[model samples]
Target: MTWLFNNPSEFAKEMISGFVSANASMVRQVSGGVVRNTASKPDTVAIVIGGGSGHYPAFAGLVGQGLAHGAAMGNLFASPSAQQICSVAKTVNQGAGVLLAFGNYAGDVLHFGLARERLISEGIPCELIAITDDISSASADEIHKRRGVAGDLVVFKTAAAAAEQGATLAEVLAVAQMANQRTRTIGVAFSGCTLPGADHPLFNVPQGRMEFGMGIHGEPGIRELAIPTADELAAMLVDKLLAELPAGISRAKGARAGAILNGLGSVKYEELFVVWHGVARRLQEHGITLVDSQVGEFVTSFDMAGLSLTLFWCNQQLEALWFAPAYSPAFKVGSVIKAPLLATEDIEAPAEESVAAATPESQAVAGQIVIMIERLAEAVIKNADELGRIDAIAGDGDHGIGMERGARAARDRAQRAFQQGAGAGTVLQHAADAWADQAGGTSGAIWGVILNTLGTAIGNQEKPTANAIAQAFSQASHGVMHFGKAKPGDKTLVDVLLPFSEELTLQIEQGHDLAAAWQLAARKAELCARATAQLVPKIGRARPLAARSLGSPDAGAVSLSLILNAVGETFPAVHPQGDTLCL
Candidate 1:
């Protein structure tokens, strides 16, 4: 659904046409998948780049002054044929020779290898530099065999600079190889990407979850789990990459490394920054210093909501070449400096704190009330469209999608608990797990925690009274505060929850019946939710878009009021003797 192309074949040709038209001055289209540009200087070694079409600014955009002399392109997510590579080599090869710099994929290896042989037969000297930077794509024993990622840029830049300086083909290849060896990359995807003209995505990631170490072509990943906060995600990626580095590189090289926070596509600049901030902080904690950092949509997959992190350990020579001036449609060197200082050992030590843990009481009641909760969760899921429409008034329309996805997951968990003959506590815990796993945004997790907390507070409590309801509400509020970090007046669900809790407590203390207290609480919640229209949001996704949200009640708060009112409507006022009480 994301792609607008008529077909994959047409998409490939259209992109090539646009590329050639725009880069006409810098490059000339050759037969097959190749494009050649004049080198900055005659007699300088030439660099040849090649890759599939999806990863833009890679094999194609890098062709220009002080970069690849030509590029061999391929169809979407498919490698260029050997003939394509050979054609590129023949067109670009001069007396000085050419160096093939490309990522390490099976298709690339097969075709580029064949091209090398063909070039040799034609009496044209050609060398190769295979970049293997994706540390997460393979095991430790296979690290050198992993696929390349954004770090390919470092290899291309370094090799091109060396070639531009008149290095021989072998020298250029060696420089590129060194850069490839020193570089490492790892990526995570919040969702899978659809290929051009494909209705379905290459793979499907469950809503509210992410896959760690996913391939560009939607290959299976290391694991899939609930989407973590930007900080948590950054830490996970940096930790994996750091673990794969030479054991003492940090101490030996003073931990100098360049970082590329690349958006896979559809990931906003703000989200990228949030991830980068965490990455930067984590790198510092590991005594790794960031020399230079770039954040943008350098390489994309047609609106895939994912990101890749690349790190290159640099020595003096490689560092010099990295900073060397170069011009290309996609890349430019603006400033150069010596590597930054790494933090001291004491400062870089890992924090000892743990992520907050769920309580024991919630685990107890989950088993007995599984069916009731499952039904409630199903109702929420069914109303997802309506919820989304309400949220669209002042927020991103994803709220409905997020809530529906989360509720279904929770309902499934409740059903599973019932089937497994689990207790009420287990059911609550399972529901929380399902909600977090299915609903990816901040609100889903908060609501899940709230439900779990409420279940815990009322564990096995039968014939619930006003006091019991107040206690459950209080606990739920705590869970929301603990997870969301929003206080009263923050224009979050807490804005509604706090007022409801206060009213419930007051009514119960005044000896009001259970249903009467709930009705009072529901009224207070509605008033509080409506009042949020006048207050500015101070938390979550709404905070940044607060200007647009002015005069609109907080969507979560409004939903909370509605749900509470629905519950009150279902169970009206009842006296202690269980007789219907008049309004």
Candidate 2:
């Protein structure tokens, strides 16, 4: 359990503040995260690594010489916003391009990928890579789907070493890719972790049983087994990892590898040593050589009482790079030459975008939008805990908090934009950006796309017609389907969105008013959301443990339905007496 925290929502913010204060000599706080305090060589490729917080020493702790140039820190178990990632990359880019690397998670992929596109458009050469090293997350045939665990250390370290050696962006990317392909990890947990101010852990293992192959974000494992002794557990981890070598070695004999026994939060260092004792013997018995083996906590899950083993198979180049000197607040290798304190890097603010003048009719629409957003925020806040409970079954247990955060952000931004004499479209656009930036996850990105696409369809100068609103819904649906890559029956928000959009268009085509059409479409969405309970998730974090999600609707689907209902309730305000301009 997390014993010390002020406000629950401020936990991530406070953690970043304390971390920066303690390591001021090594790193300094930026708008979204932290960057190295010392300067590096001119034109040296910068390596920016990050993901959700809670995995201490993994992201922020590894930002220094011989490691990452900076980190884009996000909320607890949530990916950093695209704005945050771009900020850190721009701050650290010297002359050479930047390399963005992070663990293989859906939220991380969406946010980082978006940042990469934005950076490229700004004339910054940026390469993105997701470290896929957790063997338990996917089968060998689908290794690209695997998520990174403690193997993050190996991949990040290897890539950073290449950058420190003045390798080009392409070279650093190649080394990082190779390192990820060669590393494999498997983890188990005796207990789950509780978030700050949470009443309970995300999930729990039965007494005398252990969760096998659990993730770092408090996700339950793929399977369960009886607890074993330290030696037996070590053997099990080794056997599983050995069974699936990186497609080259037919056997373990004469293999050289770097091993890490990572303690996930509550596991003591001494206990890890005992497990390492068994790991060493198992490797030796198989005639495999362990080089520069490390035993400590590198990546963690707050207070999850668990551990994992990461084996990095090394060729000559990998061996050399793997053992390279590194210095950070939480990790250090051989001595590294200290560089001079960094001159302040100027982080420029974005230029304000001018809002086009809106008509009185559109301004009335904007006022109604603020009220609708308020209702949406209220719904999300009220149901957050239940949504979180459902997501904890197979996901990282953050959907509720993420929804609440995004909805509230959208409400605030919409109110501000409306007060600034903006139109309906302009207000929605502002709200869309705020939701994505504050939420920082898969849901956040998708919601941003939905709102922004819809906003563009409803132009600022005119009062939107029923036909225009229906077209907007169709475009938003298609945009999300393309952007999120989730189709109907995927057990995602798309399951609700696609149906709702289609039904809304049909009613509008039949000459129904906007309010009437919305009412019918929202009901369709509610039914679709409830029907998702029977589906097996085809993608995202839930795919590995899809069976566990049975009998419960997808959290994303459910939340979308709730928001649609909330929106439906606001139509009377938009169309006075149910007969106002067919709006």
What TM-score, over all chains together, does every model reach?
A: 0.56, 0.93
lDDT on C-alpha atoms for all candidate structures: 0.71, 0.88
- All candidates: CA RMSD (Å): 21.9, 2.6
Worst 10-residue stretch by lDDT in candidate 1?
339-348
lDDT minimum window of 10 residues, candidate 2: 345-354
Give the per-residue lDDT of model 2 (tens digit) for 470-541: 889899999888766788888999999999999999998887778888999999999999999999999898
- For 436-491, candidate 1 gives per-residue lDDT tens digits of 54553455556556766765665543434458768888888875675456799888
Clashing pairs in 2: none
Candidate 2 runs further than 4 Å off: 345-364, 392-397, 459-463, 572-579
